[model samples]
Target: MTCQRRIVSCLLVGISLGLLFTPALGREVSDIKPANPNLCPKGREILKYFQSIYGKRMLSGYNVYVHTPDDYEQTGMLAAIWGRDVQWLPPVDEVIAHVKAHGYLLTLHWHWFFGGDSAWKSKRKTPVNVARVVTPGTPEHATAMKEMAAAADILEKLQEAGIVVLWRPLHEIDGGWFWWTDLDRPENTAELWRMMFRFFTEERKLNNLIWVYSAGVGDLKKKPVELRKRFYPGAEYVDISGIDLYGVNPAEDEEPYWTFFRAMAEVSPGKMLALGECDELPNPQKLAAGRLPIWLYGLPWWGTPSARRPVEQAIATMRHPFVVTLDELPAFGDEDPPPVVGILSPMDDGSAWFPEGSVTVEGYAVDRRGKVVRLEFWANDQLVGQLANPPRQFRWQWTDAPSGCYDLRAVAIDDAGQRFRSNRIHVNVGVVDAARGRPVTASGGENPSAAVDGNYYTSWRAPTEAEEAWIMIDLGQVHSIHQVNLIWGWKIHAEHFAIETAKEAPSQAASWHRVYEGKNLPWEVWKATHRARFAPTEARYVRIHFFRRAARQTWGGYDLAAVEIPIPPSKGAE
Candidate 1:
């Protein structure tokens, strides 16, 4: 059978099965309208609803690039269908009808090219030029017109069905990979994008479509910020701006991802933003903890669910309260206002110290207009605990929280749907005696024991102004240490120091490996604490080798009021 025949056969089979199980339509597409005159209402409502729950809730979406709409039917997830999929899978009209009947939002993206090949392989026989294709009165223009008219057929069907779509086309246009933005000639991609936008909106009169303009992380020559500015199709042509991200490990580095988000927001303020396509779904807990700006929607690439683990993570992320699934969405125009909340305990700028082991964190929340619905606590971008309504004072216990420093905050939601986040607090959990309070003798200090006597008033004074003086501490046992806090004596600080560790006693011939080094350390003045953090390492003997003093006078030399070390639970303990 021919390719078209095979596609038709597969679509018919899906439709037959759909008809047997499909239910009556729950909502009419015409009821949804964009708040902005230039955009579609359904698309606007989806964006508004998601923004309302951002940092308190997230919305889950999946792409059906190679699969039929029936794939989502079994999973009950919001549907993201690609324009190319219509040609080889279920027909476009059928997919729209199925989503509408099931009360699901539909997002459409087109990997469109000038020629008919969906894969976008450049033709060697006939070189493709975007400049010529966008210019009128050219053969390339005529070919592009014919191909786009065919795509218009699909949009016209959707319009006739009164189906509003989050339509993204010519996506990742800033990149050199796609034929539309070919590296050989990238000068005309912006013009080509504008031409297509006008063709679809003005000539075709496709009002039911919500125009989405998207780019990738970077271009061939420029970064995301500059590339987005260079290829922007203008605000009048786009309702939403987005980025296509893949292979993002949020646990490792989230700075670049956040940078792109902020850059897009700066370039197009008030416009909705989305994660257009990503291979890995971000942790919903982190998304709700204010790690990144509020995104309207997130749609992982179509084939991500082929792996079981990714699918599981996707499901869990979708299940988060911050994420809105098709079933959890509010009706059009019925979204409730979010409430305001604050954290009353543990001053935002202050650090809370807790002993190693089980501990309870406390905070207070309030909502002026509506009753507070829930209070959620986050630790290091992950949701650790939550409390239900009626309780203004919130407390959660961490039974096995390891010793370390954590970024802590609380998010409270009210009955009106408003979300309020408290200022972040730095919490330090430390194990006592990690340093064993043993006397750490320094070559230049006269009272070495004062450095570890757990007293802030007394001081350990160095005898002479020596750049190579060393201070050594015996941990008493081989322990895993992650952080060391040094308290500088009043008005005195070290100009340079190196933290070294060894399994054996420190001696002139001892093999002391350097763990950390610092230069020009500042005196806190108020708190007098300087913290050195590093990856956990096992050592019995630790030392601080001072190279210089901030004070030039030899009378004071170097003075340390106190030193503290924190140890986390070992892997064997867990």
Candidate 2:
């Protein structure tokens, strides 16, 4: 697609995913004489500024502005602009001139019909009930239309100046606390919007307005897309789509937003999505520019990084397409490079887990990109192990593991300070013994135990005949085994026993996968053995079970002496 098309697509996505809105109404603004489309010189300049930013791809570049004691000044830094008051209109010429000087557009903060500037100052939050706009000529409806016209008038000038206004009118209307709620009746909600559009466009003649709709996370529960469609002003009036979210840590709330976007995309895939505003910090690790490109409005709302410091970290982590700021909007396309000195193994480069196995690190080296590095292992102050560059997974011998918990640290150094140390990994190794022979039961009965050395350091047990019996074993490390021993008890009734291996914790018959079967043994023999040889596969659990008849001699039991798995050599195992 052309860049312009791509930008438009992105903007549309931003609109639907980022903001949601609903409204209410009163006076017949449609009947009142509409404002003439006369361009204000300052307004024209402002409109151009907004168009320069909102009309292009975020990948291109845009300027942001902030208010100052003197007239508005051009700020290189892109900052989040807030709208707290909307009682009386500002000096139109002054406000327009200030916005023009700083290259900033007016961002209207909309509230409910019953909620005037006073209510906003008191609550400092948008009122929730926004669907009441179509309440049939109510006083609240009249107040809403009047506010819409006034706000539209400001936007009209901004639009005339070629600066697009981020018109956030009647936001958070999905929440029940606001008088404009449309949760129960979405159609009426849509009607209220028709009234709003008529008042703003037909009466106020505000063509440069980029209608921003907003809703909270709760409103999504009722169906964000349905809510949007029921009240959205179609493609002509809406310039951007966004959502209002807060207090949700990106670390924790990231998934829900992803889900919400996936659903929203399905409903309105063509709108640009953005985080209209936030009263809390979002997780940077979880948010990538491609998945959810958002403009964080509030800075360091809360949390660990000192209020101001988190913003720096947030800025560091946020890449292009994702902008973070509180005071000034920075120029785009000047992102710094990724960290050079870092852990290479643990391969922070990309995800490593496969469908089949889990990773248990021996150790790894951290270093700069494209450099030969050496790793040193440390436990408290003691040196333990080391590895050179190009090495990823490290394996520790079962015997070398310490008895108690010890921190496993890996630090990398190409030359000097270019080193990274992994957070310590606690390792506690325990030992287990291997048993000899096929664990065979001496007699076929309810239960039987097979023995090796009377010392019982390593032994095997058999299953019962009443139903079916099984024995399980765990192989500590990832090893390949060629042979397995199984001993049958006197109740040698089944035609064969099935052997299986698995990687999960063994529970009542839950962890084993069938691998081998053994022929039935004659009853005369006190014990019988079974063996199997196969290519090596890493498994922690080994299980054996009678595959045929449950019991041979009695109704209530069966037996086995033991099940043993011989470990494979490490060198050629993988």
Candidate 3:
């Protein structure tokens, strides 16, 4: 988007946000042990605990709500720290119960709610006028404050319950995927950070927070400190400093972790350094053997590491002495641990298609301090499957399911008769076709799934006069076979469009890998099926990201060999 358009979305309607909260009387920053002195008692205790373990040990953490500690893993780690997102926060009472039961440290981040403007939800825009956004009395200022106020409404509950937060707002500001990051205007990013600090801590009196400044692992050429220098809000506003890492095999890229450690130490001198987020957990034994300063805590983001080997490595990493799990945490006051339950399949808002008209149920549960006696899977309160003394990775298949929307959940009952519920996931199951099923999503298109739904009677069409548009199909599970067939009908499509695939659903930009690029389609290939086959690949989702669309609607269009367009053997996507 142009700079003007970036500034346009900055406009906000309501100005009554700051009026809802009482003004702040600033608390003195501590020169003592705990970094943020004004932190709630629990927050202080958590930070102090982190300080006690800095460089000497590591805390096992995950991207799951430790409703019990038995998430998806075959062997539950019951990790001590949890990574969560603000957009979909669980109920505060549930959070309090879990923390009371587990003594877990919590960290929260926001994806800026559809890249900062709900209008841009479909077509994500990365640039922002953050400098104007922080300016008082500007519409841009209104836009940000309103969001903060809405978020503060939720945060206030945690504060009232004496729950301290490791608030990591605007995380990975150097990463262009988030709305706040504007590399060309890093100073503006800093301004935005300071604005949030003053608004949350000073204006809102949210004293139950330890502000975490999380940066992205920027370009390899730039030192971590150099990448974050312009964006750091300052030592006073930030309590912990860290960076996010991904796709790095610790054994191979060990030096970068050390480089980041030293740079974060320099970035926020004397403050506790953390691994803000990671895909692969660094081996605890390797860290201890390397003889370098270890992070205060590390968060391995959700999802089992891609394949089985990494999963095994992660399980091993959590078992080492240098790593701390929930059992090792000091008790806050022993509250009976609730049976933890999680619905591991058909994620919330995820869709599925069952060829045999049956939905497969998969989940995990554990009574950390006791034994879980029964597990049940439900669809809209109707019991679909039940198990007695279910295994860690419970499995069941429900047959004769109709195609419709369903609220799915799994419940666990402990020996003490305490029943715990898994978070609900809403999913749509569609009718399968001869070609197979396609659970689809798109940037902006009517019935995008029709393109792959194998019903030639229906087809996908681009938005009239769209600057950019895209269509995506999630196959629900990875398929080894390649080739996507655009059945029947054909036409000249976008001059610049690319076909991409990822082993998993493409949530983040990192997951997408481009396999074929169609520069322009031949005009005369109408009334025929088109297939753009590349080297055989494994993928669960295929996306056609169109940079430009045809002037007229396109039914289907392609041909690499016929059009003399060469296919590369797996080209990496940025």
Could you report the Cα RMSD, in angstroms, for every candidate shown?
A: 20.3, 22.2, 17.5
Candidate 3: minimum summed lDDT over ten consecutive residues — where?
559-568
- Of models 1 and 2, which has the larger lDDT? 1
Candidate 2 segments whose C-alpha is farther than 4 A from its true place: 1-76, 80-94, 112-140, 157-162, 219-237, 251-253, 280-311, 314-574
List ranges where model 3 is wrong by over 4 Å.
Answer: 1-36, 65-72, 90-103, 114-127, 220-224, 333-574
lDDT of 1: 0.60
Could you tell me the lDDT of residue 377 within candidate 2?
Answer: 66
lDDT (Cα, tens digit) per residue for candidate 3, span 1-574: 1212212322210122123222111111234343344666666666666665565567777776322223333223456778887876788788777665554677888777633553222355544566677789988788788988988877888788766778888888777666677667788888888888777877888888888888887664653456668777777778887888776675456767777776666666767777778865677656655433467677877444334224456656654555666645664323355677666564331134343456777656777667889998777688877899987667777775564445667888989888877756543343322223446666764666566543333456656556567777665666553454343223435556777888864888999999877665543332232355678777767787767544444433321111111112132111
lDDT scores in order: 0.60, 0.43, 0.61
At residue 73, give the lDDT of candidate 2: 9
Candidate 2 lDDT at 181 equals 53
283, model 2: CA deviation in Å? 5.2
| Cα lDDT of model 2 by residue, 117-192, tens digit | 3333235354534454566577666776676666666666656656545566656545444455565775665566
lDDT (tens digit, per residue) of candidate 1 on 156-244: 88767666677777787676566777554444777787787778777888777677777876632455465557677676667677778
- Residue runs of model 1 more than 4 Å from their true location after superposition: 1-56, 67-89, 118-125, 182-187, 219-224, 302-309, 333-574
| Backbone clash count for every predicted candidate, in the order shown | 15, 80, 0
Rank order by TM-score, top first?
A: 3, 1, 2
Model 3 local distance difference test score: 0.61
| Reference-based lDDT, residue 424, model 2 | 37
Q: Top lDDT: which candidate number? A: 3
TM-scores for all candidates? 0.48, 0.39, 0.53
> How do the candidates rank by lDDT, highest first?
3, 1, 2
For model 3, state the Cα shift of residue 204 in Å.
1.7
